[model samples]
Target: MNVMAKAEKKISSAFIYFFGSFGGILFGYDIGVMTGALPFLQADWHLENAASLVGWITSAVMFGAIFGGALAGQLSDKFGRRKMILMSAIVFMVFSVLSGVSPDMGEASAYYLIIVRMLLGLAVGAASALVPAYMSEMAPAKARGRLSGLNQTMIVSGMLLSYVVDFLLKDLPGEWAWRLMLGLAAVPALILFLGVLRLPESPRFLLRKGDEAQARKVLSYIRKNPAEIDQELASIKETAKEERQANQKTSWSTLFSGKYRYLVIAGVGVAAFQQFQGANAIFYYIPLIVQKATGQAASSNLMWPIVQGVILVVGSLVYMWIADKFNRRTLLMVGGAVMGLSFILPVVINWMMPNMNPMTIVVFLCIYVAFYSFTWAPLTWVLVGEIFPLAIRGRASGLASSFNWIGSWLVGLIFPIMTASMPQEAVFAIFGIICILGVIFVKTCVPETRGHTLEEIEEQGTNHGRVKANNPEN
Candidate 1:
């Protein structure tokens, strides 16, 4: 190839990596945006209906995501990944403005805000499912873990962005501060919409549709070495042929077949348990937790989340470096054990010394953040995105993502009530126990996905046994 051609291809490859992963920024931004905005929202609305509004506003997006994820999964399979991602970008931009422009606090206004936020939820829900799948399909085999793990980096980075934005605008008069935080998300959404315009559809998706020529064209830009490109293309073609031969239909019941049952179980278990382990409780209500523990006013506690966000972002960076180097199952076990201990120690300390320093709780939370950032946060997406066969990757990922959002919805909804009605130690202890169970689940059920192509992993089923991909005939 000519030097000019090589340069052009290099630029194109870089764009694919950068813009392809860009959807994750929007996903993370939306998730973390509300964390910082919630405090100002409560103050503006004055919580006369605080209890109900807090739960509804925080959980409304998650509720929308449940349906959005399931729908996107099915639709992406039928239509295409690029189109779904582009569509999600539009959804994100439109509803972010709507959410920001919601009317002043009132009975009708609160309901209106919840409804708009739910619409925003749809965009984020689609993003959560689609981004990882898109990246996984596009990435080279050796770097799939790090590339797929970029989604989590973007998520925590978005959280940190929101926290910083909230802190900068905290002193702004009236509700405008919160409005700006929520609405500014549209900037990234608009960028994503434009960025995805030039992106190629996933080669796997194209091969599945029998458009091998176009798939090869797309693969050439991303994979520079001719031999490597041919190897990947052949793998995808064979997998597509196998899928066609198997005559798989995108049905929910297919998940229960003997071969897929274990994959689905492990995928869904990790996805749900990732949320139930309660790291989001830290993200969603860190200010409230700090306020409760430190005896500070809720409105004045915006700076603390920066601490959590930093720990999270740093941990994700660490994961990016070591992601493909270690066994996925081993990292999961270690992370879960440390995370569980972080929660357990705080509860025991608080119980033993009723007047323990508030910093003690903060220290434990940081440790939890450190471990969770590397493990559950990124690995859940990695495992779910790559575990299923090409025939059911979209649908299975959607189902797992829906379970994830459902768990998120439950945590966002019940956490406040749990805190109000019970001791924080008891609440954290409950999560601690869940994390310990998560360790066992990883050891027993979850398979090792690193260092293998998605097709290869699906064929092998698990590290413990050779349970092949599902056969529709059986």
Candidate 2:
């Protein structure tokens, strides 16, 4: 690898990272945008909605996401990555505009809002399932974890952008600001649509489609040398060959056939548990929880959510820079610890905040957000991509991702209910317990994916060998 060629490959990887993560940006944006937008919407619509209803409004996207994820595996295989994302961009662009512009729940039904959100979730669902797959496929093998981490970066970037937009609109009167914030999402959707237009299809997908020449073209662009291209493709081919032998009937039952159950189990279990870890309870309900903690109303407490967003950005940047250096499993366990501990941070401060200065409460919240971002925020996406086989990668990922969204739905739905039923202290403690258990799961089940190529990831599924975090790649 000459310096010039290496430089060109780096440039190519950058483009792949850029375009691939753009979907994640939308993922992050939609996830956070609604949390900030909802407080005003309930008031503007003149509805006497409770916190539970608001939670439903926020989670509607996640609910629809379940189907979106279930279908993406087939869609990505049948239609390819570029088309799936383009279609998703179209869905969110139209749905977001309409969600903001809805007239009346009675005439349109509050169900209209739910329908629109589900549509938005569908787009995000597609993005969530396919973006990581596309990013993983396009990345250089040596840089896979960092490259895949781009999706998580986008997720945090979205979470942060939502808060930033919310803060800017804090002074705006009525729900118009929230409407504008929701509408603003179309910007990234449009960018993703156009940017992906210029982007090529994944070489791995192309190879699956039997376009060897086109696959080689994409492979050459992503890899440094002609030989590296061959090596990359060789691994992909080897994995695909092994997957085909595992069986091709395309049933979940087929996943149980041969050794594929390992993949199906690993992918789906991690995806579901990733969400079940209770990280999203904070992501979706941060604003509500913030208000409860201080006994403040939504307008006054806007800063509470903004602080959370900024911390997530800081955490992701730090994690992205260091992802390759540590074991992926250790990072997961560590992130769970950060999250589990942070859940207790507010309990320590809620008592002191009335007598203490506003700055004191802010500091505590910042620490919580920092720990969440650095640990659980990005690693969820990291493991999701690594835990499947080539054959079931699509189906299994779709199932896992749907399960992830379902777990998200559970958090989004139940957080409000739990908050209603339990003391804020109890809710926080429950999340801490979830993370503590997640730590045990990481130690017992999750495999390390750092420093391995996609080919190497594929080999694990077929060979029945699990890579431990501390073990060196042989």
Using lDDT as the measure, which candidate wins?
1
Point out where model 1 deviates above 4 Å: 1-11, 462-474
Where is model 1 poorest over a 10-residue stretch in terms of lDDT?
465-474
Q: Write the per-residue lDDT of candidate 2 for residues 1-474, one digit (tens) a residue.
A: 477445444436567679877898888888888777777776776543476677778899899899998787678878898888889899989988988787664524466787788888988898899888887778775677777888888888887888789778867976687788888888888988987876778888888777887788777776669888888788788767765785566777766666666556666766776677676776676667667766677666667676677777878888888877878778777777776776666566666564544344335446656766766667777666766766666777778789899999888888888878887666776777787887887787666667777667657755754665586364
Question: What stretches of model 2 exceed 4 Å from their correct place?
Answer: 1-11, 47-49, 105-109, 244-247, 344-365
Error of 1 at 274 (Å): 0.8
- Tens-digit lDDT track for model 1 on 83-194? 9999999999999999889987577777898999888888888988898889899998788889889889988888898888888888997599899999999999999999
lDDT of 1: 0.85
Cand. 2 Cα-lDDT:
0.75
